[model samples]
Target: MKTLTVFTPTYNRAYCLEKCYHSLVRQDNEDFIWLIIDDGSTDNTKELVNQWKQEKKIDIKYHWQENQGMHGAHNTAYKLIETELNVCIDSDDYMADGAVERILSYWKKYGNENVSGIAALDATIEHQIIGSKFPEKLNRATLFDLYNKYGVTGDKKLVYRTELTKLYPYPIFQDEKYVGLAYKYYMLDKQYEMLLMNEVLCHVEYLPDGSSLNMYNQYLKNPKGFSFYRKELMKLPFGGKVFKYKQAIHYVSSNLLMKNPKLFIETPKKALTVLAFPLGFLLYVFIIKKTRTEVN
Candidate 1:
């Protein structure tokens, strides 16, 4: 069995898939498998992967399924991966020169059943750390501590034990009203503390087309989705205590003020003041405009 399974779920990202494929082929450690879940791409994704598969440079597995969104691809990846540890590398992202080697070495030296997973640094544009580092010795953080300390931003930074990861399939929702795959890690945090590795392992390219870059548009298009996100987040095992009502109020108010300004105008004055504080409203508008400009 492979020690690690590195998977990518792609939909219409054929242009950048080769970078991921080539990087995997050059991994210092060969005890890893690549699982590509093609989320119903009409592009040349299948042909691209198939050529690589035929070359047999690395252990590659490919699956084709109707596009169910990111969470759906995650659900499929979890079920299919048989390795002890799993990492999801976005199609647009690639691993650093010796990332898999370093990850394997760390796991062999420090990993055990008690350690739920390992965390690594992710480099965004210009190969810089996307954010601040989590403090060392966080091998036993509660769900709240993970978010408060690590900020719970990028999915690529985490490597999960396959057993624990498979336990939480994406939660079913009442409406297609939410953003992509925000709550799964929160669910995972309830079950385990992630081991922190201060080294940079993944290079994450923050394309203007990336989902996280379009928060304002997503909010405007799907307030119901944000509401559903809040509801589902509250359902996590440790949700209520970790993510209190204040967080929810802050998130909703900020999003509305940025995406749906008219809705902010309609909010009751007292609640609005509490949710959208003095600088919060200004920052929200500024960020939205800046991000939209970047996207354009």
Candidate 2:
């Protein structure tokens, strides 16, 4: 088996997906398999990937399913991955040169059952770290603490053990499609600390259609998923009070978007939820107004 499964969850992103394919093909060491989870694209994605498969430059596996959003595609990716380790490279993103080789070397030196996998850095297309690199002195940290406490910022490249990753698949909500992907990472954080590697693994591009750029619309259309994600964040004990309160604020906003009557009852911290009401209500009103003018 390949050392890693580099998975991409794609939805109508065939235009930019080639960069990902090219980068994978250029890997200095082919210690990885490319897994593409096609989330119901009404485009030429299937044909394009078929052409790549015929080339046979490297191992490629493709699965197509109805659109259930990024988190749902992730659910499918985790289920299908058979390698001991896996990492998600967004459909619009690609790995840095030698990234696969570095990851394989790192795992060989540091991987063990006690830890889940490596948390590597992500760089922008211009080749700059997305945020501060992991602390030079630290060798490992839980994914929760990396953001919640240790001041690591921005999204990082996360490689996980397939066994543990399969255990915390992101929950799929009925008729909803925007759960924060971090839900699974935090759940795993409770069980294992991630090895911190300071090498850049993936180079990211924030395409116009990507979720990060379309969050306002996501907030308006997928309030239940957002609300569920916030509730889960509030329940995690490692998060700071301020962090939980921030989640509560968003939770309240999402609840209000859904016109949920039991917002306070559903919130993990009632007092904070109460305090966040005015702001949350304001955000809810803002999202409504914003959605009205946007065609998407």
Question: Who wins the TM-score comparison?
Answer: 2
Task: Give TM-scores for every candidate, taking all chains together and pairing residue i with residue i.
Answer: 0.78, 0.96
159-258: candidate 2 lDDT, tens digit per residue: 9999998886677778888789889989898889999999999999988878899889999889999998999888987777888888988999999989
Q: lDDT for model 1, on a 0 to 1 scale?
A: 0.73
lDDT, candidate 1, 183-290, per-residue tens: 666777766676778888888886676667767666544455454455455455554443544444645544554364454444433353345454455555665687
Q: What are the lDDT figures for the candidates, one per model?
A: 0.73, 0.91
Backbone clash total, candidate 2: 0
In candidate 1, the residue pairs with backbone N, CA or C atoms under 3 Å apart (3 or more residues apart, or in different chains) clash, namely 177-225, 178-225
Q: Give the Å error, residue 28, model 2.
A: 1.8
